[model samples]
Target: MAGLLDIVDQAQAIACEDILKVDAFLNHQIDPELMQAIGAAFAQHFQNDQIDKILTVESSGIAPAVFTGLALHVPVVFARKLSGFYGENVKWLPFADMQNSWWISILITLVLMGLVSLLLALNGFFRK
Candidate 1:
């Protein structure tokens, strides 16, 4: 498996202060070993936080998120991307499109509600 610094060296510079394109190992080629390392690193970083679940947006995040959940023995929940929300890494939000789409808001609400219900049911918070 490639080390963290080795993966950092593979990133493409985007003329940012601290941001570098990670599509080389994350999105485009999707080096699983690197993601596993990333998961382990995240698990180590947040182990003391007592996190019960891992939440992230879909696509490339799914890989590291799942691996991190595995390392931490927690459930991973990914938000579904609808339309222009698609991106490699999360840096900003598209407020204009969100303002225009009420259905998007409803869909997201429903998705969250469903996830909550599922979690509740799984944890026996919802008892018949």
Candidate 2:
């Protein structure tokens, strides 16, 4: 998906020399076509695997996750980042100290990757 990088480079804005703001197309104002392309890429990469569900966080992840789910023909399970008044009412997985919003996404992604790896190992898909 060389076009994907071009879109990113063209739309992405650099802030404070480090932070990249992709609100125009990625996080905030989403481009459906780009999301579909991303989903197709993910589906192609993991086509051999048995993907029962696509796990992602709410808001930003929902779009791409939904597209990926459609491409993979699987359900999308989105995790809520914010807690309610009755924290007990919600099931929270204390995976990490979620201070930064970006870190929360990263942590969730890592957890999903680890879970996938574990499942693959258990299913003997990783056997050489």
Candidate 3:
């Protein structure tokens, strides 16, 4: 845990507040040692929770998921993208209709949700 914590301490939060960019270790450029440590730490933290499987997105998430699954003796599920990494038709359009005197917010939300669902299904289907 300390090793992972130390790595986290060294990593910086760039640009956005919610995003802690860890490209140097667990993301873009991977450090196997840190990832393994991370997996062990996660396993230790959730040892008594009775976890059966691990779910993670493709690319960056694979390393940590594999390590955690290894340490926990569980199966790891990878999210394989079909259309694209971020999915196709993934957008939000809050267009206003003057004639109808309304904003298409609900419609946009429904469309986005449907796109997300479709993407998930496709991703699951085209697992390689």
Which prediction has the highest TM-score against the true structure? Answer: 2
lDDT of 3: 0.76
Question: Taking the tens digit of each residue's C-alpha lDDT, what string does model 3 give over 12-37?
Answer: 52538676678878667788898888
Candidate 2 per-residue C-alpha lDDT over 30-89 given as tens digits, one digit per residue, 9 for 90 to 100: 999999998998999999997887878778899889999999998887867667633458
TM-score of each: 0.56, 0.61, 0.59
Rank by lDDT, descending?
A: 2, 1, 3
Q: What are the per-model numbers of colliding residue pairs? A: 0, 0, 0
- Residue 65's C-alpha lDDT in candidate 1? 96
Report per-prediction Cα RMSD to one decimal. Answer: 7.8, 7.6, 6.8
TM-score winner between candidates 2 and 3: 2
lDDT per residue for candidate 1 within 19-70, as digits (tens), equals 8787777777788887888899999999898778887887888999999999
Better of 1 and 2 by TM-score: 2
Q: Between prediction 1 and prediction 3, which has the larger TM-score?
A: 3
lDDT of each: 0.78, 0.80, 0.76
TM-score of 1: 0.56
